[model samples]
Target: MKPVRFWVGLVLVALGVLGILDATGALETGGLLSGWWPASLVGLGIVAMLSQRRMSIGPAAVTVIGLILLAGTLDLAEGGLWWPALLAVAGFAVLAGLRREHSTRTPLVMFGGATTREQSRHLRHTDVSAIFGGSTLDLRQARIDEGATVDAFALFGGVKVLVPRGWRISLGGLPFMGGLEDKTDSTGDLPADAPVLAVNGTAIFGGVEVTNTPEK
Candidate 1:
């Protein structure tokens, strides 16, 4: 199993066990779930860092934010530290973006909605983010001659990626208090040289969906 899926399952099973124990009085959680939930985000961030081919800014940011939130929940830190953390994250993202191809367009939506359609003949990597809003990327008209990667992040919002039907899709990412749904059509019987698209990133308090068809 993929590391992301394994970690997600482990977290869910742990939560289920804890709930059962707490309900039966075999163990007293004492609001542990309510207070320590941010720890899952931390774990997810670490897992993402270790599992992917390269370290991603999204995971690093998630780790830092999770730590801050966890500290605040435990009364070990102030609740107003979000701005500083977010600024740090933005700086990191900018630095990372500088290293990427100039043709790559990083789509970011905040408190609104946006859509991007890629018709590139040599598509490579794509990054899409949504914060308190929605973002969509349509790549059905694009051609992936070689491998490609997609990094998607959604926080309190949603991200939808529509890709062409015959490419091989490898979905990897963590969903914290959120969901990741893959609806891409299978690339059955495709030649070994067929293009491969690897989707990786994080969804916190939101969702990410990849499909070959638009939602009806």
Candidate 2:
């Protein structure tokens, strides 16, 4: 789940608790059809969040439906529907952005300007002449395509690129007690300039690699 989304749910729980207290006449409610309604909605939000923990509710369609239904049930009160709707959208957004598998490949986990992910059981970076890094490859087609637009592409599994030597290669992101970029020659044809760069990250387990890049 998203950090913001989780916190929002927590806020709902707090609101629900207060609502219940008010409904029981122990506290004063602002006259919004008893505190029970708010409490009930909070309960629903909790359920939604919990369900998201194991398996995502998917694609935001269901969440939007629920939010709309909830707003309607609340008699479409003034400025009340926005929060619930936003929560639903945020939850689904996080769900859609996470990786479900531990391994995947496309010959090259290209990460750069318009790096196209060509899907195949054995991915081949025909665009370039060399590979960098010393990681494995050929994973099942994954959900989250780990391509970054401006910065480096992050990796969690591992990467092995076959590129010519002498080319500049930069990568970051390391594993616990593990090395950052272990180099190897998969094709023996390396650029004389050692064109290999491994990008590292602060995270102990995630990493990134760039290879077979033609110098502009």
Candidate 3:
């Protein structure tokens, strides 16, 4: 994937260079290059596809849209066909997003709100993302696995994670114009074999709060 991204990035850079040369009157094919600027979108879509390890519809849709735009710009396709195809692509992207949200065990909230409370006896890793939204994960009833980690990201939003008592909580993250609070209490006089839960990630213009609560 890294190699693929590198090549795609090179192609984008080459296109940018061509555009710059054309703009400066250094290239004889300046008019053609300027008119065919939609090729840059195709390069961007390729970069997006290669950057992700998992299969995602977002990049695929982007690639398709870029191709359509390129065709339209080159007079290979009618302009009327482009808009309907783009609308269809948008519908498919929404469906794919909903499917991913439903299938994943981890919680992800983007531009919306969600509450996640799984009944697993042993909790492992969980991911949370909140952008212009809020999310809450209640794990008081679940047992924390040793060295479990929570990856969270918030931008103009908030996330709250509630863990059971007696679990050791470690906070390690960066906040840029934001805050990360670990309100969990330490279990004094307890043995050193308690499970550890590490919270790590970033918050920008947002907040994350992790609190300790008694088991149900």
For lDDT, the strongest prediction is: 1
Candidate 2 per-residue lDDT, tens place, 1-216, comes to 233234445656767887798879897765554323444434433443353333222113333554566576666747777786778677655554452242222122223222334343322121111012223231223121222111121222333333334434454432332334534334565445442333322111334334443225
Q: Candidate 3, TM-score vs. the true structure? A: 0.53
Better of 1 and 3 by lDDT: 1
Alpha carbon lDDT at 99, candidate 2: 29
Q: Tell me how candidate 3 scores on lDDT.
A: 0.66
Off by over 4 Å in 3: 1-104, 213-216
* True-structure RMSD, every candidate: 4.8, 15.1, 7.9
Q: Which lDDT values do the candidates have, in the order given?
A: 0.78, 0.37, 0.66
lDDT of model 2 at residue 159?
39
Q: Clash pairs of candidate 1?
A: none
Greater-TM-score candidate between 2 and 3: 3
Lowest-scoring 10 consecutive residues by lDDT in candidate 2?
124-133
